[model samples]
Structures are given as C-alpha cells and as structure tokens.
Target: MFRILFFLIIVVSAVEIALFVWLGNVFNVWFVLFGIILTGLLGALLAKQQGLGTMNRARLELSRGRAPAEKILDGLAILIGSVLLFTPGFVTDTIGFLLLIPQTRKPVKLYIKKVLLEKIRNGSIKVFRHY
Candidate 1:
C-alpha cells in the first residue's frame, strides 16, 4: 500500500506539472488558477450537502431503532469524494463525482463490504481498534 501510494504521488505530480504547462500554453495561467479554485469550491459545497444528507438518513434510521450502517458508508464515500474532488485533476474529479452519486456509491459500498468480509473470513483483518 505504501509503495502504491508513493508511486501514485509521483505520477500525480508529473501529471499535474504537465497539465499546468499545457494549460499555460493554451490559455491564461490566471484562468487555470480560477478553474482550480472553482472546482475546490464546488467540491466543498457538494461535500457539505452530501454529508448533511447522510447524517440525516442516519439519524432517521436510529430514531426508527434500525442500524444505519449504509448511511455510515455513504458518509464515508462523501468524505473520500470530497478529498478526491479537492485534488486538482480531471481524473480525480471524475472518480470523486462517481463516489458522490448514490447509484455509483451503492456498488462501491457493496464491493468494499465484500472485500472486508472476505478478509475477515480469511483472518487477515485483525481487530486493532481499542475500546
């Protein structure tokens, strides 16, 4: 995981530098800067909206004496999406938007659950959290 993250960082930096140079050549540097700012603002607003909706759903489920596990997953997806959207890139934004949408998030959540269960069943997901 660490190695993958390190590689991703290097790749992302290279891509960002290339994008900056390309955009600088094709359009005003100031416009690219504004675009980055705009995307950040949009991402923040979307995150806030999604977070509140997830919280509300969770609260409603709790009030009905039901487990709100799915709501928690949605909240987590929103957080990840927010982080991705805040990243300056078309690739990140595309991925972030997918995670933010309910239809897309559902499959992603299910996939995550399946992977976690598999790890647990294989005894690879050891309990590390302290109570």
Candidate 2:
C-alpha cells in the first residue's frame, strides 16, 4: 500500500507538471495560471454550498432520530473534492468536480459504502455500536 501510494504520488506529480507545460505552450503561462486560480475559487464556493447542505440534512436526520449515514458520505466526498480542487492540477480538478456534483457523487458514495462494508465483513475494519 505504501509503495503504491508513493508511486502514485510521483506519477501524478509528473503528469501535472507535463500538463502545465503543455497547456502553457498551447495557451500562455498567465492563462494557465488564471485558469488554476479561477477553478480553485469556484471549487471552494461550491464545496461550501454543498457542505452546508449536507450538514443541514444530517442535522435533520439526527433530529428525527435516524442515522445520517448518507449525509456523512456526501460530506466526505465534498471534503475530498474540495481538497482536490485546491490542488493545482487539471486531473485532480476534474475528479474534484465529479465528486462535488450530486449526480456523480451518488455513484462514488455507493462505491465507498460498498468498500467499507466489505472491509468490515472481512475484518479489515471493525464497527462497534455503543448501544
């Protein structure tokens, strides 16, 4: 796992740099810089909006004495998306947008839930209930 993570970090960094250079050559340095900044600002605004909505939903669920599992997953996706958008790279930004959009985020959240459930069943993750 560590090796895979290290390799991915290196590869992603290289790809980001290559893309930056290519975009700079095709357009201009300032244009590329401006795009990065614009995306970051837009992503931040979107994340804030979605995060607050998710929090409200979670609160509503809690008030009704129901678990806000779905809302929690939505919040997680939004948080990750926001972080990716903050990162300076087109690939990350694309992924970030996917995670931010509710339509796209549903599939991602489902996949996350599936993986967590599998892990718990396989003993890789443990869940304890207070009650």
Candidate 3:
C-alpha cells in the first residue's frame, strides 16, 4: 500500500508539473498560475458549503435517534474532496468538484455503501462495541 501510494504521489507530481509547463507555454505563466489559484479557491468554497449541509443532515439524523451512517460516509467523501481541491493539481481539482456536487455524490455514495457492505459480509471489516 505504501509503495503504491508513493508511486501515485510521484506520478501525480510529474503530471502536474508537465501540465503546468504546457499550459504556461500556451497561455503565459501568469494565466496558468491564475487558473490554478482560481480553481483551488472555487473548489474550496464549494467544498465548505457542501460540508456544512452534510453536517446538518448528520445532526438531524442523530436528533431523530438514528445513526447518521450515510451522513458519515458523505462527510468522509467531502473531507477527501476538500483535500483534493486543496492540492495543486488539475486532476485532483476536477475529482474534488465532482465529489462536492450533491448530484454526483449520490452514485459514488451508493458505490461506497455497496463496497462496505460487501466487506462486512466477507468478514473483512471488524466491528467492536465500546461501552
């Protein structure tokens, strides 16, 4: 896992640098820089707004005496999306925005739930009760 993560980091960095250089040459350095900054700022703002909504839903679920399982998963996705948006890369920013969109998140959330359920069924996920 560590090896794969490290490799991915290296690849992402290389791709980002290559893209920066290409964009810089095509549209000037300042334009490229401004675009990167604008995307990051926009994505951050969107993530923040969505995060607040997700929290409210979670709180409402808890108030209704039910576990906010879906909200928790949404929160996790939002967190990851926020982090991706914060990262200085076009690919990450695109993925981050997708996760930030409620409409797009529905399918992703369903996939996450399905995978988690499968893990539980296979005994790959361990659950512990704390008293």
Top lDDT: which candidate number?
2
* Model 1 agreement with the true structure over 34-129: per-residue lDDT tens digits: 877887888788888888989999999999999898898898899999999998876677778888888888999999899988999899998577
Candidate numbers, best TM-score first, in rank order: 2, 3, 1
lDDT of 1: 0.87
29-117 in candidate 2: lDDT tens per residue?
A: 99899989999999999999999999999999999999999999999999999999999998889999999999999999989999999
Off by over 4 Å in 3: 128-131
Pairs that clash in candidate 2: none
- For each predicted model, how many residue pairs clash, with residues at least 3 apart or on different chains? 0, 0, 0
TM-score of 1: 0.84
Those runs of model 2 whose alpha carbons end farther than 4 Å from true positions after fitting are none
lDDT of 1 at 111: 92
> What do the candidate models score in CA lDDT, each in turn?
0.87, 0.95, 0.90
